[model samples]
Target: MSEFLNVNEIKEKVSLLNLLNKLGFAAQKVSGSEHFFLSMLREEYTASLCVNDKLGVWYDHGAAGVSGIKSGSIIDFGLAYWYPASFPEVLKKIVEYAGVPLEKSHDIPAVYAERKTALKSSTYQINSISETITNPAINAYLNMRGIGSVAAGHLYELHYSILDSKNKSRNYFASGWPNENGGWEVRNKYFKGCLGHKGMSFLQGAANRLAVFEGFYDFMSWKVENPKDPASTLILNSLSFLQSAKARAKQFASIEIYFDHDRAGMLGSEEFAADVAGSVDCAFKYEGFKDYNEKLTAGLSASKKSLDKPMIFSAENGFGR
Candidate 1:
């Protein structure tokens, strides 16, 4: 098999529920087409993770306040379930669990054939794109991330549909931005995925300096803090595009990297700094937080708390300054 993996093909061919079963996780309860199970991610007395068998999606009700994703497609679940695993590794595991062959084969298994037939019609179609974002949910999500004010020119309101196995289309909306390959990097509260070919987003600025970020939210967070920055920016959208981003950074005299503060982010930052001379890892600015956006949101929360505090007119410490 080639090193390249067709992610969409695997998603279409694999059965998420079947994979869960293979992993020794059975649904604690079943409600119509939805199956409820204890979160594979964390221990819980009640089942909070729900797998919608009909739509091939999962959502963990208890994960909203936790780090990582709360809801997404099967691929997203795989990545979250197998935390710290590379994308290729996750894909291989999914294929293995689903009993699907990595390479194309004429002698397909019966179970694999049934899954393919059931999911063949599952697809995401873009219905329309609006230059301005107006959806309340999208706006709330952006504001929650402390980027609503800066997201105006950088994002769009995307109206799309997901075609299910029964040939019924479910309409949804999200905030999206275009990538270099003319595809969209879309995100809402519950979903995050590319609408087409995944690639990095490059924003033109200074020719001598560049700032690289792992995702668009981090880029926007930096913009929120530094509105006057003149450096050219590259949002990798995914760490898998680090090699391409590094090659692009070589043209600039200086590069600033703001990856997450996790193990993978630290390794990526170190690798980029090693390959490209004059490159610096700027993740130290958000050292304790996961990423730039997390730091930004924390700052916003702190400011809100300060504003809400009651003032005392005592002489102690000059009336609390």
Candidate 2:
């Protein structure tokens, strides 16, 4: 008779990466000892599940953490695989797979026992935040991009940094927007990354109808364009936030999506429209441009160039000649 085996026994003995490989989940991407895969349970374009071979842990970022599971041990993964299965059944299946005897035990692995962190928070530290845009580089960057002072005023000047795979340090000082996970989506001319958790940034105003933007810059540009008619807004820092945005869109009577004029944006808009009955895609207004900000910046740059041109009057160049 196959005896029962503890969760720890499975985790300590079973190699998750190897098991995944054997099970035909070849890693889609690898960084150092961590392997990323495009999730076995769902259809997605990007790899979300991360298996850390060094720490002997796996993190499934599928569903933007809405699944309520991120990092876990092999047994926990088994439970996700055989969802709604009894613990005894899960244990038995693992035992049969790993060729481990079902020795009765109550001990679960420490890795699986670790407390789950709030999925929304990210891994970056926010050293400082200010209402004023004091950094000259940031100011120039924003102004050059045609993001007005009104939009800049609402943004926080953030001091933050992110570490690479080798644990190397790269710091940045940029304008930041706070996401639902309390992470700062930091951006400057030179760098772009998140500090803390990653999710959508929702700003509540008048209800019923809401405006959605793919990036904070577009949201701010929208604000600059329509300061008086401020309504509820959702800033999806990335298309990855599309699901979370969809969930949030339910509370509003209608939604206006302002995504880029790209293939991903078109697909995302279609999905959003399908999910929300009254959702409107406002991208057509800025057609032929990548985004609203691009149009705004291009218009501003063209005006500046026109003004910079010297007044040269000749027979060929007729200006009321």
The local distance difference test score of each candidate is 0.79, 0.71
Instruction: Write the residue-wise lDDT of candidate 1 on 1-321 in tens digits.
Output: 436456667667787898888765667679999998766554344677999978889999884311255677787777666533455666777888788775643333354334334333444678999989888999999999999999888999999987654779889899999987556788999988776445689999999999999899999999999999999999988765666678889999999999988876887799899999989999989988999999999999999999888877776565662
TM-score of 1: 0.62
Model 2 agreement with the true structure over 73-105: per-residue lDDT tens digits = 776676555433445676777777666564576
* Best by the lDDT measure: 1
The list of candidate 2 runs beyond 4 A from truth reads 1-124, 161-170, 313-321
The runs of at least 3 residues in candidate 1 whose Cα sits more than 4 Å from the true structure, single-residue gaps closed, are 1-120, 311-321
CA shift of 194, model 1, Å = 1.3
Clashing pairs in 2: 3-102, 120-181, 120-197, 121-196, 121-197, 122-196, 122-197, 124-196, 208-253
Compared with the true structure, the alpha-carbon lDDT of candidate 2 equals 0.71
Worst 10 residues of 1 by lDDT: 112-121
| C-alpha RMSD for every candidate | 12.2, 10.4
